[model samples]
Target: MTSPLSHLATHEVTNQPPAPGDRDLWAGDIVLRQAIARHGGQPGALEPYARALGTAAMQEAARDANRHPPELHLFDRAGRRLDEVRFHPAWHGFMQLSAEAGYAALPWEEAPGGHVTHAAMVYLASQVEPGHCCPLTMSYAATPALRTTPALAPWLEKLQVRAWDPAIAPMTGKRAITLGMAMTEKQGGSDLRANATTATRDGDAYRLRGHKWFCSAPMSDGFLTLAQAPEGLTCFLVPRWLDHGRNPILIQRLKDKLGNRSNASAEIEYDNTLAYRVGDEGAGVRTILSMVHHTRLDTALAPAGLMRAALSEAHHWASHRSAFQKQLIDQPLMRAVLADLALDWEAALKLGLKVARNFDGTADEHRTFARIAVALAKYHNNKRAPLVIYEAMEALGGMGYVEDTPLPMLYREAPLNGIWEGSGNVICLDILRTLAKEPLAGEMLNAELQSVTGTDRRFDAALKAHRTRWPGLPPEAEARWFAESLALLLQGALLIRHSSDAVADAFVATRLARGSGRIAGAISGCDTGAILARIAPVE
Candidate 1:
């Protein structure tokens, strides 16, 4: 006991965390890159640009942006009633990078891939920072509705400009602009028709006096708000500033959200706010729905992107972090979990891109397909994201629970996309409504599924079962179940059509053939190695 081994000292073993950069984000995501090519995007410029975003320096900026969050300044020091929201410089940096990357510009420019390419860009940028995506998405979606109103047409070009100047000055002084929207009021959450806001005709403009329960990105140059007019509920474009003075757009307070803190969401009051009508006086919902449709697509893409980022982190950690003298990824149970998460994300990407490509086509068939598929994709992917992210976080054990890691942020942001455009029940009901009105919707969906006939016997059986049970199924109370089945069938079809044998087989066996369990890491007999390899962030 007295003769201690003094020289035999313990040394701390370091299982260092993954270095996030040193690779191309776009090229590394093989599924997304393949989808980009499939959709006809050149990818020449996107590769290097995406790599820049993946740099450690850029990732640091993303962290800083969110860590600092945005600060709301309701009035100036002199109490001059200046409604402004101040952001960390990092947030502005992200905005400039994303705007120049063509996330918003692609759709209006009618670039090579149109919405398909635009969706890819959105997916990449979201992997880094998601809050700024709100303003960018609103700007991109605003084009169609803006085109409908001649008064707002001039701002369309401004919306498309690639430069992002976050100046609080007038639109005349800014090189480019982003947009926001305010739809719901305290009385009406999803029921917009219950809105108490009122708008009065004033010459060529209108004066709005109402309180919006939720006005996202309140600092935006303009907002498309819904208010009641003499005709009915109407859409109005309320600008931040006018030639006379700033519109009486009073910022009540900012929402203390769980995540996406980099962007400011405000509860605002408009007192005789100057606004211009966007569509027919009585057709506010119909007019703004075109924009809503586009944003809903973006909403779906966001969760997919977040899932990709989380999976990359988990994979990186597992490959490097060891236990019991072996890498976690090499362990059987861990491998199964990672593979299962990968399968879910890969299927989501395939479906999201497919719906986006449909938006690019002008055929009536394409439009009809998108009417139903968007809701299904949005409903399923957004809802599943939280579970995937949670499992990915658990894959890292306690390391994932700390703020020093990105997984926590991803987990917090996971539920937002599901809640943003619409919640699960709202989206499911939308699907039912579409099927009821456009009876051709079912035929269109079936025709799309038929393209992959005989690809997988399991998928064939599942589709047959769904068609057989259609008459007996009560879609009203069981809307979510129908939506889930529709989602799985669509994802299975896409996997069969585009993915490798391992991926397709896993999706069919687990998702379609009644072999999957309630949780991740439950599938068996599938090539987990092949499934894991396909989702590898880099070679």
Candidate 2:
């Protein structure tokens, strides 16, 4: 009984992009706004760029960058050794925008709560496109290490520049510059101490001769690499170009990665490459430690932003599409799922920024708390981002699985953050190390939790249990479990203080009191509608 025109009508599509923004992506996020306000930032100032990032043009740039991944040109015409990486224009556009936004060196500028402000901006920008943020993160991280090396004092001006100068040239000629890192070798993955790259003494500098298996942001103007010097493992600043010509950093190849397609990671061989040693020759690990901590914070924050992006997409789709003659969002189970995702997102924001705020504090206690808490936050939040994003994707059914939508991209990006900087086992072991070596960290954590001693009976009981049994640390076999417990306890405490009654109640009931597994939507009947409404973007 159907007419021929019925087929044409059925071809219409529903549920898609063009999500709303507050002239800035930062202001639209209630949790982000709360965190920013608490940290003394005027969200309105970031609105313009945030709105630009959400535009069709910027979103297209993200897709185009990934669609056309960076390609390597190992040789130029006439068989000259070129060793360059060619990227799409969209990649440069993304880089330039972020660079101008001051994501790389805002905290170093000594702004009020600058680290928190930087973290929030990074979180917002990452939701738009994460791959381009890689080099930006490295530049931001490298500032600490660079500050310690007096020999490189003049080059410090280049790092502080806010412009995006992507020209592949000598740092001496460039007005602005970005930094990269090459630490891992074939034999050493996370264990930088085992690096086999050797740096021999040269006149006023050193000559590096070895291979780096993972050289992040190979196109960067400079890199912070590790090599074995006469004393021990050392850190060196290897410029892309030297006085004579381009450094002899032979680009073995660009890694064919699963995700982060917009950015380039390379494997390179250093053939007597010139480099300037930073810090004491044997104190490489100590010198790069601060850099590592900064990157880890961004690593944890990226996934949280990725989760928010996925949730936004899913929520937008649900709000528009109808099934069984009812809007998708109106369904009870979907409500529970979205609400649960929102709860996790809020927890991630609260915890991530809490650690960042500690970075800006001048007190010794704040530094101690950050030392232990950063590891805890990075481990749990990064590990959970993928699962959370996948669940949010599931809320979309078949459409979420398709490549045309952003879900596929978000899904692919989920594991990158957790794997980078440090993987799950590595981060957990770091937490255990902190517990064994740093007593002040534990004391600060305990004191922080005790502030809300009677907020929730469940949280109080869990804290008591943790204090009593935490002295005898768990063995390596159960380090993950121990770390997860610490992270959950910290999140619960932060929520009790920062979050509203509804969010706090839901988090404590599911994460602490019940002690349930990792299933999304496990917490039910706890103002699911309220949380979902707060997080869902208003169009």
Candidate 3:
């Protein structure tokens, strides 16, 4: 499909893959639809949001928001303290769009499968613009944490609104609001106990005097922060604006980071910042755990979305571009590469949504399984996403490295979710800790792994080998090995139960039985046609 005037030009733009401008993220994704339905998540609720995010307008806005990053506005012309970060209009537009679509409010609005649908929305939005997802994810995760603090009833009520009110006003003045987390300090990266920010008790609240090393979405209505109270480290809710005026939040500078440019991350200091304690003193970690748990679900699903977007590009390019008297997609080696990539993408999403379904687990096994399973999903999905994206980029030769396509943006975002919440080692150690401490978690995980044991001998041998490798928990050094093995086994189990035989066989062969090499696709025998059918080529 070319313009009628193409004949008048020096040469026709022949053999070019059409731009993926008008894709329907929900409609085109058969895998996503079936996975959600199979896991009991309502796809009807996701259709509207997915369709809107895939529009060409939203896609361009995503690029613009990242191209022009947020600028820090430190002071007003009158010399009054005005610590604010101004984003491009496109950033605000996406913020409003996702807010209206329930990116943050869906779970709290109380749908039967809200968490599952929310996880699907996370995957959809991350495909278009992941930068905007940070604040919304914090908003969604903070809902459960805020339940412990009854003093913030007004703010909690605002969370129910499925609209974006970007007004820099109090909760009473706004129809909707968002919350941010600022627990990481200068001294303690992941260790909250090392926080030196001190909080002194005030009448009904406390005044915090400390600097937060990273404060994302600095313009957020409020932030959930941690400070050293006399009792111990305590979680506090610090509002950006007080009734009197702006709080003493000093924006030191914004972080110039590798990716997630559309969202702002800044280093700000709390200069006697007025705040309200969230939970019991010394229970900061326990209180924040709820937020961390929910956010981990997003982190697990984001990489799969990134993979899907990147591979879709490669799939379209190879289908049309010709080489050596054959289309690139027709080449055996290319098909193998794409099929392997699709395998990982499919497994990741299935496992992630399955974990989301358990977020509101009524059964004890469901609750405990979700706790340990999310750690595994986040750790393993992120481990493969970067390489999967890089391989997809290489499929286009040199064009993939340029900015004409979204490959570069997807690549930059691939490694982000891995770093957020918990890094690789941190997640691996957490897996070991959860399995050792919670006997039910181990039992639930064992039940999941053993569910499909008899169906596939390859998966069975892999499971047996995993158990025999370390009769008990492996040493700390073997945690990564342990986590990867368990995650793969779990993924294989799910595919056996839900996916087509072709998909299950390929996964068991390459992943569980180690049929592939240390690369994306090196397997000799696989149902490449059936696997490649998971994604459609450009028509």
Candidate 4:
């Protein structure tokens, strides 16, 4: 007779294998190779880690496109997901792989490359799959939902499998489940108070009644839904599938968008459907903030991968293309432009890493430093990537603009970085709000600035000018100042963190040794000594 575990083994073994298109294995491998090259060809350092992450990414990519393929009604005219898709099994698998690779604990790493790798992975994931990996949002939404509905607690733990370990136990190869958090009704986007959804407690469950303009992933298993509870505005875990396992949620229509064509957006109506409460009454806004921070970081880093890909494409084009009877790269002006693009790309990558570092450093801080850093990163890349791509496009003449070149697809994807996970204005405001609550946030920011610029008069003057422009004194004025200062601090940190002190110094010394006036001028302009002095005091 077979042992009792034999049946279990049989069942587990019989589970369907991941389908042919279920994994974007090639994309993950390509990204890993690119990341290693960008970081000085240290493939051995991250190869093991990359292999693990690539496996997960491939699995998720396949799930994202195939699992419950976004129906015709789930998207807007722009192709954005109007309803949140339920988190797919692949989503959870990737998150689990990341956690296993020690990405979640990366703040503790002293070396910058580890942080860069994590940041790069984030960028890659967001580009490959957006909106689904809103862990920050889910963490915020799930905690409260779990407390009220004890039955949903197990699912909450299950959700973490996607982010922490998708290849083990019950979650092995399982995908993520998504929770929708956006509001598009008449009340407005920023003000949750204007929401009209109502929840009436009915014994063990509640009845949800409302019309949500944009519900991302409506096909998802459940949502951390915002509805007006008796006490105040509250959130609930409303399942798309009802008690008997039938979907009560209705998808009114899908949106067709310019970018992120693969993602589905839908307008949805939530009838008097059964729902479970999350957290206490009137805490929907507070809970949602957690999710926002997570997504903001994601939104911030998403463009970097695209930028890297575009830069690589441009570099290849420059080396091969010839103009004016000379290789494009041989032209001084073109070379200068390419060099600038490289600098910008490097700067963007570093900025993203710095943000990840901060995220790793202060896991418990109430302030959303990661969110601010992510916003700045996104804003800068959004601004710089297009310029780089266009320059590359010009280098290729007509080919770059056409689909024949990767630049066209990249160009189309670039703008969406600025729009999603909260717009630029929204991100700036978020930083301001976070800094205002933590007054020391400004001083800490100053400390980082001091580290980079030292105590030089020029650097001091810049700091003073910034303070004067936006002082952290009056409540309103202080908030603005804190935001601006934080932005500066983040920028300075990125510059220092990503810059190889040895390389910069060697480059400068060689130029000075050769009597290169331009190099000398750049050195003089930088006020390195002053910056060092200021930074020394902080250390």
Candidate 5:
């Protein structure tokens, strides 16, 4: 069968505008049109290239936003490429479909579906492909304390090989070749202060010795690895193949993961391998953190996409499936559920777009909003999606639990959203920390709340009541309390489109009138409706 994305191959060539009826295609098409216009209509110009790359990258990311493979295997058991297998093309087609649909794509053909793919693609394009040199180059850039690091002048020139290569393609729908970021050791995941890998300064080259766990994209061409230099933590570029020498790294094991099975996550060892320092020593953590900030956003987006897909399935199921001699759509309960899902999905989608905009260079206010928005979207979507999946399944009776239904896969994959990037606890803590540092964040939040309350006196009254009832507290305590409260605030901000104060206020009022109890539940994390109500409310 011809895949839905078969049209994309000829989309540019034909010069036919996208149909206005399909919102996904229209969104992408409009963006592309604006980008082309901004670039003076020359598709090959640098600005145009960047814009096209960004647009295509987003589309690619959305293609596999939700769904997981049957197994975790970017490569076969024998450590051979899995893309060579027959199923690769089908999976690729599926990815394109998701992208065209404005859903998320998977890293590997069989990985769990979600918005992470979009974030990953964007991160790869912005940070890895355009920001730094290859993984090897990034490692070399982090040598011996990062102070004496040489300018990347020579390496940066050589990194242009990626532009022509185009790791991701809209027409062919091929996956990009990855350069693994393998930094973690068994002793530590985030606490790089405890990494034990060593890089001894050999005569002409550094000899690396270490074991790395969670080496993502292990089968890629090279790795950006972190090692303990005599000076401090340093990074190195270790290639899979050398022009004149044999491969130096050895694969120890591939992790059997709960999600993202198509992307290789391996345990690896390097023994006396020759390496070049990236930047100065002790800069490894800082450099990697920069890279990871982008990666975390990507990770957060993946689950956002998954939740969207799950909600979509729920919407479809509710509208079509029948029970108790009536269509599920006829039930007030189901309508409420579906409505909440729609609201949540729209909020997440808008939040994801806003984050992308900030990454593309928006104001500091937008940047702050994007951070809070992304975190809240990830938190709420991760929690809400499974319930939608469950309700969808329940509505479908036995069919929902069956493998034949997408609901089962969505249910299994939903939990990973919360775990990947960072757990809910970690993200919430980060949000709290951000609130602590920026008194302005709270003020901005309060402004937002007031704006929302202004639209409906009732909602304003409710918010005032809640605020008054909530005692005055220190910044730290306020941060904790505000985590959930801020989520609600952002939810209102998003629903109002953040485009106008009045719309946001109206959304808050409507939500308050219909779901005060549910809102309270969300803050406490007890009832699923707390999350659901944010998305689909009674009103």
Candidate 6:
């Protein structure tokens, strides 16, 4: 009864799930929906972009863009210096889609709950293509740093445009602009103060001369960099395109990175690169920290999306594929693993969104909470993401190890966010510093942890035990443990308050009560059916 089209086929394609067709990222994610409303964001703003991102065409686009990474073109046929990095059309298609959807411009556009909306979009788009997210994330983060320089007002205005303008023209002629950053040098990976790039005052602007170890989004219209000014370390805005011609900024080479292959990162030289100074000279770190802070939020939010994508893929495979003459999902052990992974996924989303919500808070406590909670979420979420993804990948057995599935991409991407902005130790130390320096941060964290108190005896006991163990702050050696513990409490508390009893109980029971073994699915007393239902019920 097979169609004539299949007559030449080796065999019928059965048991394989239909290729994940068009998925409404927003519509399908009930947890994301609840988080949006709970955190003061309107859902409609995310739907259009979500729908577009979920299309089969978009899926192909994401796939093609990564499969064919960006190519670096340093010169034209005439031997003229080009210093341009060209991408596959599919990459540009994603940039255009994100640009038009206001991914970078959303928070600054005066939309209600802009940060929350932006955070959700980060979560959604990351599930589709995370590589393209770097430049947009930098663009979104650049607003505050740009605002400090009145002379750069025009540059700031250009960023607010709700379009993706990828042209070689000056900002004056461009409808929109995306910015990049080049801060770290060979001597200074995370220490901006160690920068040796020199900047000399030239009329109203400055001329920079040096090389950077890393220049994120090398093809971006302009770059925010740090250079050694006469005063001290200073932040400079280096434009790639000028009114007359290209600036002296030269691309040395694009980084052969481990992942995020779709995005172009580079090493470059500023041979007297024309630049405008941002913030006061010597306050470069302070000014650029604003951008870093915002970028950190995306780092936290992106891992959640990665985990979800991996989980979805594994869930689909399990549902369709059979083992031992029974469906994989029907096996109690498989269900436990998927359900356990779901707990981490859900916890990350809730914690990240909670931190995103605080971003919209204008009050003092809100700011304090945002600063510290972002680090906690970023630290722990990133740490757990790789493991969660690896477990999900394992569920697919051998197929998971191959690039034919999304598991490899998801796994590679899982570690990048952790390295960017700040690594694990950097974030942990930052947490300790914040607790020591900012009294309100500690107070707000305590208030958050206590809010869900008495709801569960185990949670209450864990909280009490945590406070007793730390007393104030643990030693530097215990920084990771301290940070992880606090982040877990916050995640557990949020899950209890916002999630279903099944989710709340699984989290507290396995995580808080230590009812589970070290690895995922190593637990007892879990309602696997109820928890797995959150992922997708097995028919």
* Top candidate by lDDT: 6
lDDT head-to-head 1 vs 5, winner: 1
Evaluated against the true structure, the overall lDDT of model 6 is: 0.91
lDDT of 5 at 337: 53
Model 2: residues with Cα > 4 Å off, grouped in runs: 1-24, 42-45, 515-517
TM-score of 6: 0.98
Look at candidate 4 and tell me the lDDT of residue 218.
46
A best-first ranking of the candidates according to their lDDT comes to 6, 3, 1, 2, 4, 5
The digit string of per-residue lDDT tens for model 3 on 1-539 reads 45445454577777777667678888889888987786667677798888888888899999999899999999899998799899899998899988998888887766678888889999999889999999999999988888998988888889767888888887667888899989898888988889999999998999999888989789899999999898998888899888777889899999998889899999999888899999899898899888899999999999989998998889989998999999999999999999999999999999999999998567988889999999999999999999999999999999999988889999988989999998999999999999889999999988988888789899999999999998889999999999999999999999999898999999999999998898887887899999998887324
State the displacement of the C-alpha of residue 423, model 2, in Å, after optimal TM-score superposition: 1.1
My TM-score estimates for the predictions, one after another, are 0.96, 0.96, 0.98, 0.69, 0.65, 0.98
Q: Write the per-residue lDDT of candidate 4 for residues 461-538, one digit (tens) a residue.
A: 555666676665435535444444444445544444445443233222322222123311223223233222211110
lDDT of 5 by residue, 1-539 (tens): 23245346546332222211112321223222332233222222223323333343443332232233223333678976432112133234433332332222122122222222334233223210111112222222222222334543333233322222223222123232234578878897767779999999987458899888767655444567789998999877665555554455766666676544434456778888777677767777766655545455554444444555455445445555566877666666665555544454444444554454444444677557555656665666566556655655665666567754445555665576566556777777777666667666666557666765555565666567557755443355455444555565556655553423433433454454443345311221123333333433111
Residue pairs in collision within model 6: none
Global CA lDDT computed for model 1: 0.86
Could you tell which candidate, 4 or 5, scores higher by TM-score? 4
Candidate 3 backbone overlaps, count: 0
Tens digit per residue, CA lDDT, model 6, 1-539: 23334334587666666567777787778898889989988677898889899887898888899999999999999999998998999999999988888888889887679899999989988898999999999999999999999989999988977788787888888989999999989987987788999999999999999999999998888999999999999999999889998998888888998889899999999998899999999999999999999999999999999999898889889988998999998998999999999999999999999998888888999889999999999999999999999999999999899987888988989999999999999999999999999999999999989999989999999999999999999999999999999999999999999999999998999999999999999987888888777766122
Pairs of colliding residues, candidate 2 = 23-47, 24-47
Model 3 earns a TM-score of: 0.98
lDDT of each: 0.86, 0.85, 0.90, 0.53, 0.49, 0.91
Cα misplacement distance, residue 37 of candidate 6 (Å): 0.7
| Greater-TM-score candidate between 2 and 6 | 6
Decoy 2 TM-score against native: 0.96
lDDT of 3 at 445: 89
